[model samples]
Structure formats: C-alpha cells, structure tokens
Target: MKARFTPALFAHAEAVLGQLLRFDHPADAVVSRYFREHRQLGHADRAFVAETVFAVLRRGRSIEARCAGQLSDRRRLLATLALVRGWSQRELAPVLKASEEEWLAAAKAMPEAELPPAVRCDLPEWLYARLEQQFGADETLALARAMNQSAPLDLRVNTLKADRETVLAKLAADDITAAPGALSPLAVRLRDKPALAKHPLFLDGAFEVQDEGSQLLGFLLEPKRGEMVVDFCAGAGGKTLLLGALMRNTGRLYAFDVSDKRLVNLKPRLARSGLSNVHPGRIEHERDQKIKRLAGKADRVLVDAPCSGLGTLRRNPDLKWRQNETSVTELTVKQASILEAAATLVRPGGRLVYATCSLLSAENDAIVGAFLDKHPEFTLLPASAVLARQGIACDGDVLRLLPHKHNTDGFFAAALERKA
Candidate 1:
C-alpha cells in the first residue's frame, strides 16, 4: 500500500509496535523484515511505519507514563504520532474511535515535570544514573535528548580513487545537497538521507557509508603504504576498507572477527572498495593461534573492540532497552582481554589503536588505563596530535567523540606505540 500521512499508515505502525517492544532483534532489522514480508508497502508507507516505530522506541518510557502505564501497542503508536510528531486529533480522527481521541488529548496535555527524571529523559534508571555521574545532571539530559534524535547519514570518500571535493560535487550535481564534514577530512555529510545503494559512485567504489567518528579511528591508526596492519574485531570491515584505502592498497591489511557470518558480509564490501590489500578471516577469538605468527610483525593494529553500541542510539534506539549493566560488565572483560591480545601484534615502535563505540568509561578509558598499567613497553600517543597531523582538530588526550559534543556517534580511541 502507498501510505500517506493517513490513519492507515499509523495502523501499520501499530501492528508492528509489539514486535519491537519484545526486543528479540534490533528494531531496524525487525522493521526491515516486516516490510520485506509485506511487499505491498510503498517507500512512503515503510518510512511512515519505521519513523513512528522508532519514535516510540526512543521515548517508550515517557510515552507509557503519559498513557497511565497500561497502554497497549496501539495506544503507544498513537501517542507517538500525537506527542512526538505533533499530529492533531482532527488529523488522527480518520482511524481513532471517539473515546480514543479524548484519551490521546489527555495524554498530550500531561505535565512534563511531573514525571521522574528517568521517565522524563526516556532512559532506564540504571542508564540515567551512570550517565549522570560522568556528564552531570544537566549535560546527561542534553546528551540523552541528542541521542533520541535521528542520526544524519555520513559517508567517507575513498581517497585512493576520489577526493571529498569531487564526491561533494557529484552529489551536488545529483541534487543530494551534501557538504564537507566538520571533523574527518574524508567525510561528507548529507543534508537528507537518501538511498545510495545503487548510486553510480557507490557502485564504482568512490565512497562508503561510515560515521564521521569512525573515520577518525582510521586516521588515528595512520597506517603507511607498505606497513602491515590488522583490523581486529573487523565486523563487516567498515574500518578495514578505510585503512586499506589509506594505505593506498599497498599494505597487507588483515580483517579478523569471530563470526564467519559477519566475515561473509565483508566480502562484497571488500570487493566494492576497490582495494586488493585486505584479507578477511574468521578467528576463534582474540587469542586464536592464527594470530600468533603475526605477533611482533604488524606495523599497526586496530582493536575496534566490541562494545555496548550505546553511542549509536540515534540509529539503534532499541539498544538502550536491550542492554543493561550486567551485559556491559561482561563486555568490559572481553574488551580488556581482546585489547591485550591485539596489542601483541604491534611490532616495536608500531602503533596500536584501541577504540569502542561505547559511551561508558569502563569499556574505554578504564580499559586503556588498565592496559597501560600492565604493559610497560607501550606509551600513549596523544589523540589530538595524531588527529592534527591529518588536518582534523579535536581536544582531549584520548579521542572521545560524543554525540552532543561532536555531532557524531560517541567513540573513544587511544593510540599506543610500543617502544622500539
């Protein structure tokens, strides 16, 4: 069905609301599957259903609070349209019962300050408390609000084949209205999200979809043309492609991950990337013996360690509900172990860049601190200095890219060099 800004579209959103609330998989994946199964939905219809479902996911706690705590999936979807999208009762009357309209009006009129802090911020209590400690009360709320909003699409121009100006011009000629990214020199920020899957530039390996913060990690790694490099935890090889391009496709870049499923997805991207230096392989874990020979051999190693994915809330809002402190605690242990194992691959005087898409200190700064404490041969390289060499300027000894601060997904990276 080609849905409009009509009640029928809202009905479709309501139908899938419960599936998202169950949190069996990511909301985006669930929504994609729903559209795939229901092939009758038009692009606008899918967009309407997706946007409404995401809005509810972002503010479920607050929406439920407004609905007197017993709201069903249908009511949650309706409340999202009314409160978040600002749809008027008259516009919604096409699908609502007479009594339902009255209830929605009451929900919309509820006082904001009456709700608890966590509810007002639409965050769970544990998450709110943790963020409050680091960001303080005022800034935590500010960060939460930023995360609740939609993420803008960011693409990194393949410098080996095309430059940023050239790509920006092409996008402009196509009426895409893109501009140079403020942070990463390789990045281009689009004014509006468009499907670039079939664009000529994408098909020809001119650029790849990467967050501006993620592009920063490649810069921090700073792989040279002939140096050996490893992208540990290279899920789908997003960063591996950037690293290969930076090496001008002259270096041996190994992309290792635990899942063959993820490694398989990387094959197409590696082919489209127009780079011949990358080797994608599946590993048992960070300690797999396949990496033993590479120890003390690689010129640079990037441990883009697995994390809670909390920094990507703008794109993956359901992660907030799916994760808790227990999961984060377990991840910290794995992250530390992986970092220690990947550090072994760095040759003397070679660089090791550890990064995470997490907002928490335990997964980022603390882990780095513990590693530095245990390993006397490695010394910290200032992230600001490394970024400055690449024509990007950001403050901090470590690269801490927060959504509120950088307008990119939250990321933390520390560059370490093994003493020669």
Candidate 2:
C-alpha cells in the first residue's frame, strides 16, 4: 500500500534533509541529485520540496532546540512548517500525528532567548560573530532579517542582442511584466518568477539571469573595445560575458578559472550569448606559467576573487549556517594569494579591479590595503571616478552595496591603476 502524506515528496524531503544535516555537499548539489534520481517530480512539486527542505535547514537550529532534545526528521519537518513557514496546525495535521500536535504546542511556547545565538539569527555562531564585528547591533539585525527573505529574479539584457527597452517589449509581448532595475542599465527586475529557459528571446540569447549588483561589476571594469582584458577568476564566466559585451565583441577577453568544470559550463553560455571575444582557459592554479605569460600584458584585469559569499544570503540562506570563522580565515588567505597573482597580469597603465561578494572589511578593505602596501606600482583609483568616466554615476572610491541599502547583494569593489 502507498504510504500516507505524500510518500514520494516526504521521502524526498527526508533524504534531502538528511544530506543537508550531514553538510558534506552543497545543498544545491544535493537537491540537483535528488531531482535527477527522481525525474517524475514536476516543477511545482520540486519547488515545494526544495523550498520546504531549505526552510528547515535555514532554521534548523531553532527547530531542533524547540524539540526539547527529542529531535526527529518528521517532528522537525512539522515544526518547520508550523513555525518557520507559519502553517496552521490544521494545515500540518494531515502530515502529522495527534502526539506531534502536543509537542508542537509546547515548542510554540518556548522562549526565544533559550535558543542559541545561531538559532536566534538563523545563522551559525561563527558567522554571526563575524558579521557582528562588521555590523553593529541594529545593522546586524537588519541584515539578518533581509537575508531571511527570498531574492527576486533579475535579468540583464545582452546589449549585443537587445537593449532594455526592446527586451522589455519582447517580454511584454509574451505577457511578462518587468521593471527596470534600480542600478543597472541592462537589468530588468521581473515581477514574478517566469520560466525563461525556452522563451524565444532567452533561447535567442537576448538576456541572461544575473543579479543587478553583479551586472554593475561589468560596468565597473569598463573595458574599451579591442582592449586586452582578463577575468582572473572567471568561474562560469558570469562577469566574463558582461566584460565581453562591454568590449563589444572586439576585444580579446581571457576568461581564466582554476576549475575545468566551471570553464566547460561557460561554453554553452558563450554560444547562446553571441559573444565572439571570449577565450576560456583553465589554469592549474593562480601561479601557473600560463598566467605568468600574461604578466604586465593585460590592459585590464578583474580579480573577482573567491569569497565567503555572505552577500548572497537572500538566495543561499544555508550559507550563513554552513560558514564559520575558520572557513572565512582560510578564504582570506586564498583571496590574498589570488589578488597577488592577478595583479601581475596588469600592464603598466592597466586597471586591476578587486571585488568580492563579502561585506566584511577583512575580505574587502583589508585585502586591498595590504595589496596596495606591497605593490608600489599600483595606486588606488576612485571607483566613482572610474564609473563616472564611463558615465555611470555611483557612490564613492569603492563600490559598496548592501542588501538594506542597495536592495541587492552586498558587494565591494575597488579599482587600482598601474603606474605608467
């Protein structure tokens, strides 16, 4: 006999939750594998299971603590639906037992302060402490709140294919309503999530789903046509495509990454994008001889270094729980090494831009500061001036975006020019 309570879905959720609790693999990877294993789930069912499981992981600590040490997968799921998802007891009753109802009632009455700091903020303690150092009490609270919310899908119209107006018009023709992004000229903020994979415009490469904040990074690079540009950490070529577009497909854009897998993924995107200027290469590591060949040869280099990805909390809430102080410190070392290696690729008079998705000063300001101190040939250029030169007016010497301030992912960028 078929089990009660959406057996297939419940089983999927249970398996996913078990994997998530183990924390051995990325949540997305686990979810993807689950979907691949069970190909029968439709889009809506997949979304529901994925969202529900992520909700539990995002708020697992609080839920587990509320269970009074009697934590089981089923009880946690019921509590997650009730407390985190705000589902009514009657609504959850179908999936839960009468005994579970009493447990939930007791859990509902538990005081908030009794839970751990990680549970309180829905983040790991180490992450909470790190953020606490960067953000004051009120700001930390605000950031945590913002991170808990879902991110809207934003798309950047490939200018080479279509302008914002044309893209918007095309989308409207398909009965999709989109508004201009607050920050990026090429961006369109969709009112709701619409499947665009097979949309004629998307299939024709008119637009790509990218965060507005990320789109701004391409503008910050401001590559001129026919210039030699290098995206030193071009994982999957998200920014590489933008830089290629900015160069108007006339420049030699070298997209370098340490991971061959990421480089392979960029190939299809390159074809769909109609960009002819990009050259994707896999480096053995940052110090590869292939990288040395380009030393002082690039007119522009972007070190979009690997980071903690704290800025993307809205999209990956699980990160706040998975990240810790030790992991961040390790990342800082990698960032410094990558920046040092990438800086060598910039020619005298070239621009080297350092950027990260982290909001922490250690990863942002401190990394740049130490690099500037070690390299006298490189001097800081006002990012505002750089953007202004390109006719893009934004705030100050470094681009700092916050979820609360910019309604986008927290991003930090600084530009340095090699002394002529």
Candidate 3:
C-alpha cells in the first residue's frame, strides 16, 4: 500500500534528509538510526522516508544543479519530488512555503541538457572522468543511469537446504512474486522488496539475499566435495555459505575476515544454512598466522577483495559521495596486498578467483594483470570457459557483470589456476 504522506511525515523525511546531507555516516545507518529513535513511524512511513531520502541521494548532483543558489535539504526534497518522483506542483502545495512556490517552478524549468555532464549523470567529477575514459561518455552516462536507479532484490537458493523450484513454489503460495534470474541458475529475483526477516523460508535458510553477480563467483571457484576451500574476506559469510553448499557440506570451508563483528554476524546465518563444513575465523591482517598456516593447503580460494564499492551505487548511493579518488587509490594498494596474500593459500593445480565489486580497472583488471606478471606459477583461466562448464554463458576472458548489461550489481572476477 502506498504510504499516506502528512505534514508530519514530510517533517520527518526532511529532518532525515538534513542529517543525511551531512554524509558523516552511511545513508543506511543514518536512516536506521533515525527510525530507531522515532519508533512511532509505521513500516510504510519508514519506507517512504527512506525511499525519498535515497532518491535525493541518487540524483544529488542533478538536484543540486537545479537548486543552484537556493540549495537546502527541503529544496532538494521538493525538487526530487517534482522532478524525479513525478509529483505535480499542485500535489506538493500542501507542504511548500509561500517562497518555495516560485523556486520550485524555476527549479523544474532548469534544462537538464544545459547542466554539466557530471551533474547530468549524477556522479562526482573524478568518477565521471575515470568512467568516461574507460567506457566513453555515452557508455558512462548509461552506466550512471543504471546505477542511479533502485536495484532489485536478488536471492541465492541454498542447494543444501532447498531447490529453486520448491522455493519458487513456496514464494508463490505466500503471494510473493519472484522469477528465475538470467545470470545464475541458483538465483531468484524478487518482484518487490519485502521484509523477509521473519519469513519462514528465509528463517529456515532455504535461500539467501545475495546478488546474482556474487553467486557467479562461487561458480568460478567450483569447490569439489572433498576439497579445502577458503573465502578470504568473507564479510558476514554470504559466499562462505555458498561455497559450503557447493561442496555439498562435505569439504572444509574456512571463512576468514579481519573484523570479528562481521564473523559474529555470520553465525546465525551459518546455523540456518545447515552447513557443517564452514569454519569461521578472525585474523589480524591478511598476513596473519592463521592464513600463513593455510598456505598451499587450499584447493580453492576466493579473494573477494574489498574495493571502493562504487559498483553498488544502486543500493549504496551514499558511497559515491563518501568515496573519493584518493580513497580508491589507497584501496588499490590494499587490494594488491590482499590478493598477493590470498594467492599463497592456493595449492599447486588449485584454482583461485580474484574478484571485486568495483567498476574501476585499477581494482579489477589491473590488479589481476599485475598479479599474473609477478606470479609465473599461476595461469590465467578463461572465465568464459569455466562459467560455460557450469552452463553459464559469459563472453569475456574475465567475468564482468555490469548493472546496465546484466541487471546485477557491477562485479568483476578473474579465475587463475596454479601450475602443478
């Protein structure tokens, strides 16, 4: 049901937007905190506030361009409603101040074609320039357009607990619409975002809320039933559960991370996943003794190295505003170090997959290229071939899933095998 907006709800949304514009914390965190503080908000009320605030964030640059000298959170919110949400000026008159009427009209009159290219794309100048150089101006704009929109909720079925068909049937019985995802055979794309925290199927761990693109990474590793596998940087054990299920819960799968809190968060999910093969461990750093002991013992290792997270703009638009070029450059250095450390775990003839949820080449292709140059013992495997073996059709030597092309979060993965 559509949330009924009142003057008070608008006040709540405006206050939340004001806080978010500070950009000191993640957008989700800020909104969640606000909701916690204001427990009086109904579910639909919270959803309305969050959706409105995120809409402004996604088109922040564009909305600011229109706001010009009169920039304020309220103005941005008004402009977003009028310009993006298709709210007629007549509909917005209930909350608009006398002075804002003319401003809203003029803001709507601002020609988008006349705005700067970066503003038009709703991206930062440096990010837009880098993307343009890599993908050309037209393609970058297309990518930005895709990223600026809301992302669909994609789920991965845990084969260890339930099959896709059964899960689909259950969702149908519950009146929750979903369909098979185009990319991963185990993927289920939901038609709408629903609160699944209390859903019996989700509580039972029949499936997980994983991006379809991320699910492909497990396919790249292809852990065998008795093989030892490691998910380096397994934040919250999303892929760890996937690898354990892929191995049919018969092999040892280690979930390692630097954050104890993230590993702690995985415990509940791990219990629901019905996987006995996963071992969660916290490490001080990439070169910690825990990782050192596992060197040359893993049959498959997945380094889903942390990056700038620019690829997740559709879900985390705040990141584009929070992350800058310097942060990305710093991340590249750390990514190289982590990839190097993780590669040491792969035994001779074992497979290693280096992946990132980053669109920048420096984090994806460049890191893999430099790794291959330094490590003569590891041969770059054609990602297309490996995915094809599992009935996935990928065209590139590396697996690159773009939001514009694949309707999944942007992802890049390269598969490598150690020479025996």
Best by lDDT: 3
Instruction: Kindly list the per-residue Cα lDDT of model 3 for residues 213-232, writing each as its tens digit.
Output: 99999999989999999999
- Report the Cα lDDT for candidate 3: 0.93
Per-model CA lDDT versus the true structure: 0.90, 0.85, 0.93
The model with the greater lDDT, 1 or 3, is 3
RMSD of 1: 1.5
Error of 1 at 18 (Å): 1.7
Per-residue lDDT tens digits for candidate 2, residues 132-160, read 88787668777876777667889988989
TM-score of each: 0.97, 0.93, 0.98
Model 2 residue runs over 4 Å out of place are: 1-7, 111-118, 388-393
lDDT measured at residue 132 in model 2 versus the true structure, 0 to 100: 84
Worst 10 residues of 2 by lDDT: 1-10
**Candidate achieving higher TM-score, 1 or 2:** 1
What TM-score, to 2 decimals, does candidate 3 have? 0.98
Pairs that collide, model 2: none
Error of 2 at 234 (Å): 0.6
Give the CA lDDT, 0 to 100, for residue 106 in model 2: 87
